[model samples]
Target: MPIVEINFDGLIGPSHNYAGLSFGNLAAMKNAGAVSQPRAAALQGIAKMRSNIALGLTQGMFLPHPRPNRAWLTQLSTDVDSASSELLANAMSASPMWAANAATVSPAPDTADGRCHLTVANLRTMPHRSHEWPNTLAQLRLAFGNEQHFAVHGPVPPAFGDEGAANHMRLTPSHEAPGLEVFVYGVAGGAFPARQHVEAFRAIARVHRLNPERTLFAAQSEEAIAAGAFHNDVVAVANGPVLFAHEQAFADKAALLDTCTRLVPGFEYVEVPAAEVPLTDAISSYLFNGQLVTLPGGEMALIVPSEARETASVWAWLQRHLAGNGAIRRVEVVDVRQSMANGGGPACLRLRVACDPATVDPRFLVDDAKLDRMAEVVASHWPEEIAVADLGRSSLIEAVESARAQMLDLLDLTQLASG
Candidate 1:
């Protein structure tokens, strides 16, 4: 089987808004109460997928989870009108737009059964995101349902918080070959919550039936977490055989890289020193949150947010690195300011799964024509703007529901409306 990495991005929801629900995310907190342009945000996300396709990458999509989550609100014994402000915000949260937290995927080559495995993330640390697993699991099951090629598992117990692939990385000679899987977890001493628990990943490894010798675990720097690097991908990302990361991304960087060198053949790294790009600058600009992808011509490119280009240190580093013949040969800047304000970038908006595309559900895949049609639905039905205070309005709720329904209908995925 020819395995390729498919990026499944979550479509920005019609309810996209800035509620500042993420405690450790500086961008989310700083931009709280700001009016959001759902239509523009969704279109921007669609354009990003289109760009990846143009680059000869296989693109997939996961629909927005049903928002104004009445089911969750009902569990709390209140409806939108009667719920507390925090509860209401949690219910209306559009944070699911960050698909990087959707699951932890182990490609077929790395698993004992020779079948790809994905475990839906529990996201138990944040109340707003804690309820995401069921809907996400439904979508994962639908997309990777071919039993001969894939195995999808439910989330680990909520006792162990797991933020998913945002905190995971894999290094291999090729997507089809067995790879060394690195699970980066965090310790909780930081002022901010460390979302990915060590035990959570251990549970996933066992469930996935991965080889013990092939799996490695590392601790995310407490400094990175306190500086608003809530997930490892915020400061580090790996593609093929190259690991691109900030100097301060891991607690024991030397040992981790040493282990990686021993386990992964031809392992390479581009470590950005903190002296050059301060951790604060890194988190704020989301320099590493961009997708590090292998292009069709066998060169690697860093797909970064436009903010990275604006940040002097980040842009300078990229230019210097590219000029020096680093593993990242090119930097492709994209506009994801809408997602950036909510503390996500190109990498955050996608979940990377290495598998044979033919084994995956076609409805979850996209072409230029499919994306064009999706963009039309977003323009026609998505709300133009959503003020933070307007989250409770019955009109906004109905509009959000109607817009997502239209998207589902357009994709012939109406079955997910109830998921």
Candidate 2:
């Protein structure tokens, strides 16, 4: 029996398998320009264990050190609070609009009609993290005029069993994601940080994590997904074979395929056959969202596939998919490639946020606080560059369109309700 894996929806935000978000667009919180370039006078030994993709993510700040001078930040500051603030401040400064949009409830940029928020009356809370964050959840409610619901994944205990205080949360859809999902699982105890899930998501996470000691445990780490969750799972199911970064499990690759199938058998696996294939230093060199993306600059480029080389298979899949739908009438499979001997894939580059599914759940309909809560998330992420002016315009467009689509679906489901 040929081994294959399945791609399933109903996992939360962004589509990668793990996360630490509890509400709205968290990625928009950080400075997009922060990691545009490295500050090292001499670009030597920049990466070690991971590729340039890993280092460039500003992970250097969180990873303890980027240079041989590991204690550089601590030496510059007296307290971790100052260091953390400075790090964020540094990222914010790189962008022209960090301090300007400091407050969450600050009306969307360039709008001067009342509070510019939905629940101007009273908003709510948003999940917080040491990572670069934006306005509070309360402010987000103000942005959407209290109409949309926002939710993020809270950190949780690692499936592998980290001691305490989950550094991250795998924000998978308890219901369904609109776009993509990446999954990683590991042991309860590992060299990695522990899990930390907020008040939400306490119930379903443990089963999501198994023993970190074995290959199955290897499947239990963090996940990251991009884009929103579609109401329809039928759209979410992938129609191709599973591709891996490397045969990470080596001889156990067979069992890994079996495990993926058991997880979602409707999907299949297609491995790039191993013929004593020499390993590359890249963390992962797979296709994403129909693009051949890579991070080539790494401490050890030879060991990892950090070089942003274009893969032809990825281009083919993308051309077929993109030409089928979307606004592009004509398809151009231009090889927009770059290199960052980086740590991981686009999956690792992103984080998860809201993942509300278009389901007939009474909970979704009854929750009066849903949309209002969502607006709060919107507020938290709008940095100065993406002003409330522009953000609100696009958001309104999306909301109106979403509501219209949902209404049509409701008309169909009315038959089911009536039955």
Candidate 3:
């Protein structure tokens, strides 16, 4: 009955492109229309997973939904025969590559029924990402439908936007222990829209039957939101007793940390002072967005992007952090520049779930053999570079469809493919 946290990363899909569809994501906007390498992106992601496996970490993967997302196109009354308009451009978005937005998972330890609960994100705030719920839900139901241990709920009502785990954080003394669940939402933000609604956050907690005393709802700072910390994960991340964040990450940050200390034993707060690293630099380098993972030897490691290592301020901060030798003892820099170009980082590409492996769906579990096969498919079939102008080309569509279909076959998940 021992429980462990598994990282489920989304395989960069064949349709990976720089469409600049996300309004709040600076990199997505800056790199809009640049040529994207689907093959390189997928390989980089797979390689990261492999490295984690080598480190004895449990890893899983979620396949990308087929694109140009016919379900979305049909909703706009557009068909393949006449789908050449720019209006359908966002429909081709590969936003699903950021699986942290996939769904909010409540481990059995935190739920009242003692069953793990997963609710897909509505993602209704953005036109480009709004269509992902149905497809994401399909994958969830198929992978977690073993009803004895899991209860997969539909997306929250569209009236209230839900951005999933991107805005949720769970704090436990250990994977098997029931602990406090923190739901971060934004109320007053600048021009950029606040994605996680307060109502949605409350509803999710209520539906999961989380103990009210153990649940805390924190407000994301407006400054962080304006600086492109569109999701709470961008500004803060949690791993067991440690909550790593920026000084300005949340509104009334001191009180929030105080509450966590009172609620969870051995709770630790690690903050990067605002004077040391400005919000601009934090968002640009994604310093706070790094994945805080508990290593096999009972120590924690920060899996960060190369950008963080390259940025002078972030680099200095990390060096000092490692020097402190507190909860986070190691720093591993990964090259996910392809994904970073679209405003996602190591943390953004994954969803962390704590549970017993036997209770979960085996189809999603990843091992060395499966990783090799998926890498082979990427090299053989995925396109090296795709431009915005080429998004509507029949040849590009054929290549994307073929590559995804083959990936599904290799994973024995052909059922997820569009017929």
Candidate 4:
């Protein structure tokens, strides 16, 4: 079984806006109430997917969950037709655009049954996101329903919060080999609540039947959490054999490094010294949130947000690191300012699935032709901009519904369209 890691990016939804709904996310709080360009956000997201595909990487696209979520509104004792108060507030959430939080995928090579496993995240940490699991599970079941090679599980109980890939990482000698899975969780830190629960991580591992010997649990630093590293991925990311992280990413950074090296010889740890790049600067610029990818040529590349380039410390570090003879050989910057404003970046916008491309539903795969078609739909139907004040307008609801319908139809997934 030859497994390749594919980046499945969520197509930005039409209702994207900065409402500061996320409690601990610094970027979201700082940009709240600002007008958002929904059209540009969707297009920019597509362009990022297109660029990765152009580099000969396997990429997939997942449709956004419908917003002004009528079901959620109904649950809150109000109908979408006449929603008010917290019902309306929850309806306006655009948190689905950050798909990396969508699910935790354990590829076939890392699972006990030799089937790719995906567990949708409960995302119970934020009120705006607690209602997303049902719809997210529906989309996952449709895209990965192939029973022979894939297993899609419903989220763990909400008693313990799980933020999916944001708190999970897998390291294999190669994509095709059996590898180690790292689950990172945090206790309390500062005024912010810890999002990833240790019990939830352990439960997910047990459900997936991952080898106990190969599974590792690392504690997220309280310092990182208080400094706005809400998720471990914000401070560290792991690809194949490399872990690119900040010095304070984990509670016992040196011990974790030693363990990884012992588990898999030649495992590389690219830790950015805190002395060089402070934790505050790392969180602000999203230095560790960049996508660490293996290019078609076998050389590695780091796909980063433009904000990382603008920050002097982060920019200087990348230059010095890439200039040296290291595994990461190239750097590419992308503009996802809309998502960035909402506390997401390149890594936050995608879910990685390691498997054979042929096994996936072809409808979800990305290519030049499909990218063009998606772009057409976005250009013609997506709202040019959305503000917090626009949430109450019937026109905005109509626009969101209409745009999603058009997108579903264009992709030949009319079954997924709202009735």
Cα displacement (angstroms), candidate 1, residue 333, comes to 0.7
Quote model 4's TM-score. 0.98
Question: Positional deviation of 327 in candidate 3, in angstroms?
Answer: 1.3
Specify the highest-TM-score model's number.
1
- Model 4 stretches with alpha carbons more than 4 Å out: none
TM-score of 1: 0.99
lDDT of 2 by residue, 91-193 (tens): 2221101111111111111112211111110111221222212222222222122332322222222332221111121111121211112223222223232
TM-scores vs. true structure, each candidate: 0.99, 0.31, 0.98, 0.98
lDDT of all the models against the reference? 0.94, 0.23, 0.89, 0.89
lDDT of 3: 0.89
Determine the C-alpha RMSD for candidate 3 after optimal superposition of all C-alphas. 1.1
Q: After superposition, how far is residue 6 of candidate 4 from its true place, in Å?
A: 0.8
Clash pairs for candidate 3: none
The residue-level lDDT of candidate 2 at 414 comes to: 24
In model 3, state the lDDT of residue 209: 91
Query: Once superposed on the true structure, which residue ranges of model 3 sit more than 4 Å away at CA?
Result: none
Higher-TM-score candidate among 1 and 4?
1
Residue 370 CA displacement from its true place in model 3, Å: 0.9
The C-alpha stretches of model 1 lying farther than 4 A from their native spots are none
